[model samples]
Target: MIFYFSGTGNSAWVARQLAEGQNEELLSIAVEIDKNKEYKLREGEKVGFVFPVYAWGPPEIVLRFIRRLKMIKPEYLFFVCTCGDDTGRTAQLFSSAVARKGWRCAAGYSVTMPNTYVSLPGFDVDDEDVETQKVHNAVARVRFINEEIVSRVQTKHYNCHEGALPFTKSYFLRPFFNTFLMSPKPFHATEACIACKKCEKACPVNNIKVTDRPVWGDNCTQCLACYHICPVHAVEYGKVTAKKGQYKGRLLRDL
Candidate 1:
């Protein structure tokens, strides 16, 4: 089984491509979390985990879900992380986590995708030309990875960079950001909101509630799904995001 956790559809697109190429089953970690289900890999089936990198590490929800996952002795295990730029020690962190769960991570890879973390300064969604190029490159990478996995390659790591800054940022800055910066207090819906509840349903954590307007709760992963998925461009993350462009990766319907 190939499990994926996506915010704005980048990782979802990668997971779908990999699954299709390998003829493996694709599962959504968010939907599984919402349903409160425990997953176990079938005997002899290889397992794959795909997700976006957050703050140089895996998202908290992915970690939580992995902790709760129960897997039988699988033939192999691999992970693919999608990032806007470089993946700093994310592969190492994921391998460590899976190791703690008594599973040996056979391989780890990263694919560069369009930047989607617009809540912070110096970060914005890529322009159409750049985004298209990134998607094209990602498709080729996923195709190559599928071939490697099908060959049962024992490669341990791929496309990861580890250094002092990456280590410090992931270990120190990540905790600070996850604790203090990831909250729903900054989100607000404007008059453009149609009360479609797209933001509410798109929220992987169910941190949004739609009445006359969308209300944000304390739980937020800073995934930016609400902001990117809003059809009417109604969601805003403080004044900082007022003029920033929103982005949601093309859905399967669009494909």
Candidate 2:
């Protein structure tokens, strides 16, 4: 089973591609976790994960979900990360986490995507040309990644780089971040808001609650899924973010 956790559509899109390309069944970790209250992988199935890289590491939710999961060792396991640049040292951290779980990793690869988080409006407003370049790059890398996946399935040997250090300021740290998240902050609508409410519904973490005014929840992973998938381009982090803008790592959409 291939499980994915995406804040933006990038990880989900990648997961979809991997599943279709490899002919593997696809599952959303958030959906299963939410409905079942717990999720476990079937034994003997090849397992994999695709997600965005945050602070040079995996998303907080991914860490929480993986830690809480119960699973038997798959014949092969792999992880793919989409980032705006090189993965830095976070790959090592991920490898260690899996090692502790006693599951061998098959391969870890990084792809580039447009950095949408920090790009500012009037500063780096979405550049189609740059985005196109990133998409092309990802397509090129995916071909090689497909080959690696095939080899790993055959050999059952893979090594992943450790990811970045977790931002552990203690339990209080999460609550602190939540304050900004749950408040009337960040999101700004473009002229494009069709009010479809897809953003509110798409939030797996329940970060966006559709009240009279959409309310953000405390527990958030900043996966950017809501932001990227918004059809209207109606979301913005803040004026500061509008200036700095957001960015994803190296991988762009494959097709």
> Judged by lDDT, which candidate is best?
1
TM-score of each: 0.93, 0.74
Clashing pairs in 1: none
lDDT of 2 at 18: 82
Model 2: lDDT of residue 175: 48
Candidate 1: Cα lDDT at 186: 85
Tens digit of lDDT per residue, candidate 2, span 27-79?
Answer: 88886664544445555556778887765566767766676667766678888
RMSD of model 1 against the true structure? 2.0
What digit string (tens of lDDT, one per residue) describes model 1 on residues 135-171?
8887788888888888877874565544458878888
Model 2 TM-score relative to the real fold:
0.74
